[model samples]
Target: MAIKAVENKFKKFFYSRLSLFLLLLAVIWLSLVLVKTFYRRHQLDNEISSLKGEIDKLEKKHQELDQLISYVGSQDFLEKEAKDKLNLKKEGENVAMINESALGREVAGEAATTTSAQNPAGSNNENKLIQWWKFFFSR
Candidate 1:
């Protein structure tokens, strides 16, 4: 008797147009919620993967910086810097210095030759008057 009554109630609920419409709406709402949840989960997963990649890159950079620091602190690097920047050498070691001004003049001479080849008249004109501004202001 109890089973029959439950079955009757189920049939009545299923047959009602209002109840069926409400049921369909509930189903649609639940599906939309599920889709939203899945999309958010996917977004979070991508963010996590990118963050992990960034961490790996940072770790590699840190290792490179540590190696550079160790190398810079060594005696070899110090000796090299001193020799290059300070022009220091051990006793009895001959240091041959190149004349920087002469090398510069050579380069300037080549550039002047090329410009004269391109425009001979223009070169002569520009060269003469170029020093007039500096000449007039000189003490």
Candidate 2:
């Protein structure tokens, strides 16, 4: 009978409110650790994705630079550069000389005529003195 009483006391201690409360606390702690682990994993995944995108963009730029290097080394590009920078020409080629001053005067005259036609009231011919007076004194 004494042994039975001891056994009952042991069972009551194991099933008491204090034990249940301690168990609940342990469960909450473990759940918080699990959630933190999952959040860190998600953050790492996003970082990896962004890094991969940057790598892809850099690789594409590297490919474009390689293509440009190849093009610059080609004969066509070299010939064009020589013709433009060195003023070189092939055999039997004729070169024309343009008078820039004459072209500029013609263009200016045409523009003035067009402006005068567009605004006839604003295009009256006035002497320089009259023009200066109007500019300084007119409201």
Candidate 3:
């Protein structure tokens, strides 16, 4: 008798349209939630990977800067830089002075020759001025 009553209740519950519709809605809602969570997790993982790459790049740059600092602190590197940039000389060393105009003329002559060879018609007038500006600004 008890088994038969339970079986009747199960049959009624299974046939109810409201119960069936609620079960379907629950499944669909859960699926949507899971998909959204998965997509968000993937996006966060990509962001983490990008940040890790940036960290590696920064670490490499820091190492390079440390090496440069050590090199600059050395006596040999300082002496070489001083000699090249400041024209420093040791005892018994003779320094030579060359004319700036002559160097400029040589460079200008070479540039004119190259320009004529490359472009027979003519180059943009603003190109040289822009290049000079860029060189000055970049330095």
Candidate 4:
């Protein structure tokens, strides 16, 4: 009878220890799963917030482009373009165009005469390459 009671006690002790180990393992696995889920949720939230900010910027840009498009399509913009590019003018409006090349030539001739008068000896001493360079690029 003493030996039977000892065997039964051993069995009960072993089962209790096994059950405790299994419960501990299950708790650890559940904790790991919860931690991983929280990390994933945090990553997704950060991505969502960044995307929302990008969307807002894009919306603002879109609005600005729409305004620019409307302005470009207006009649005032068309008239301005015609006057500036095509030289078109309204009736009774005087349009004066300056002759730039003729004015430039007159100014350039005076400059060349003054430069030559100031340094006649220096001008003569210059090489052919220097002379050609001055002729093409002086003005």
- The lDDT leader among the candidates is 1
On a 0 to 1 TM-score scale, where does candidate 3 land against the true structure? 0.64
* lDDT winner, 1 or 3: 1
**Tens digits of per-residue lDDT for model 3 on 8-59?**
9998898899889989999999999999999999999999999999999999
**What would the TM-scores of all predictions be?**
0.67, 0.67, 0.64, 0.63
Greater-lDDT candidate between 2 and 3: 3
Backbone clashes counted, model 4: 0
lDDT (Cα) of model 1: 0.93
Residue-wise C-alpha lDDT for candidate 4, range 18-109, written one tens digit per residue: 87898799999999999999999999999999999999999999999999999999999999999999999999999888899999999999
Model 2: weakest 10-residue lDDT segment is: 120-129
Point out where model 2 deviates above 4 Å. Answer: 1-10, 97-102, 112-139
* TM-score-based ranking: 2, 1, 3, 4
Candidate 3 accuracy as lDDT: 0.91
The worst-scoring run of ten residues by lDDT in candidate 1 lies at 130-139
The segments of candidate 3 whose C-alpha lies over 4 angstroms from its true place after superposition are: 84-86, 102-139
**Prediction 4 global C-alpha lDDT:** 0.91
Candidate 1 lDDT tens digits, 46-130: 9999999999999999999999999999999998999999989988999888899999999999998897778778767787787
- Assess each prediction's global lDDT (C-alpha) against the native: 0.93, 0.90, 0.91, 0.91
